[model samples]
Target: EDKVVQSPLSLVVHEGDTVTLNCSYEVTNFRSLLWYKQEKKAPTFLFMLTSSGIEKKSGRLSSILDKKELSSILNITATQTGDSAIYLCASNSGTYKYIFGTGTRLKVLA
Candidate 1:
């Protein structure tokens, strides 16, 4: 069976704290890894990685994919209350089916 797993299902931190969220997967012929942040509106796309050893970043958020380990990491540095949201990790294989993790709920306090 194919699946994606995310660690530290929930987190609470101060405004300036750094947080690392993990996602591991086991799928045949993995194609890509995607990250999203869900807030009051809808889930916003954060990144998509098709290759390993490369980091995709935007502002205070960054993510890396490790093909060998079949895992990915999402890092948020100097977080703010506005950064609080439910992070989602998803993976797809050769087929067009995506398997997603339950998500990591992050709460940044002021």
Candidate 2:
């Protein structure tokens, strides 16, 4: 079965804390790895790592993919209250469907 799992289902950090989120997966045919931030309604794309582009970085967020290890990681530096949101990790199978992990709920205290 294809699946994605995230560690530390929830986290609480004060302002200026650097946090790391982990995501591991097992899939039949992995096409890509995606990271999303879920604050409301729907998740917004944060990063997308594929064979052509295995690393993606944006501002305070960065992510990398390891095809051999079948895992990925998301790092957030200098977290603020505005960064408090659910971080989701998903694996895109070749079939165009994504298998998503439950997500890590980050709570940044002011």
List per-prediction Cα lDDT, in the order shown: 0.95, 0.90
On TM-score, the leading prediction is 1
Q: Kindly list the per-residue Cα lDDT of model 2 for residues 1-110, writing each as its tens digit.
A: 88899988999999999999999999887888899999976899999898643668899998888877888889999998999999999999877689999999999999
Clashes of each: 0, 0
lDDT of each residue in 1-110, candidate 1, tens digit only? 99999999999999999999999999887899999999988899999998998999999999999999999999999999999999999998867799999999999999
How high is each candidate's TM-score?
0.96, 0.93
Q: Show model 1 residue runs off by greater than 4 Å.
A: none
Candidate 2 at residue 10, lDDT? 99
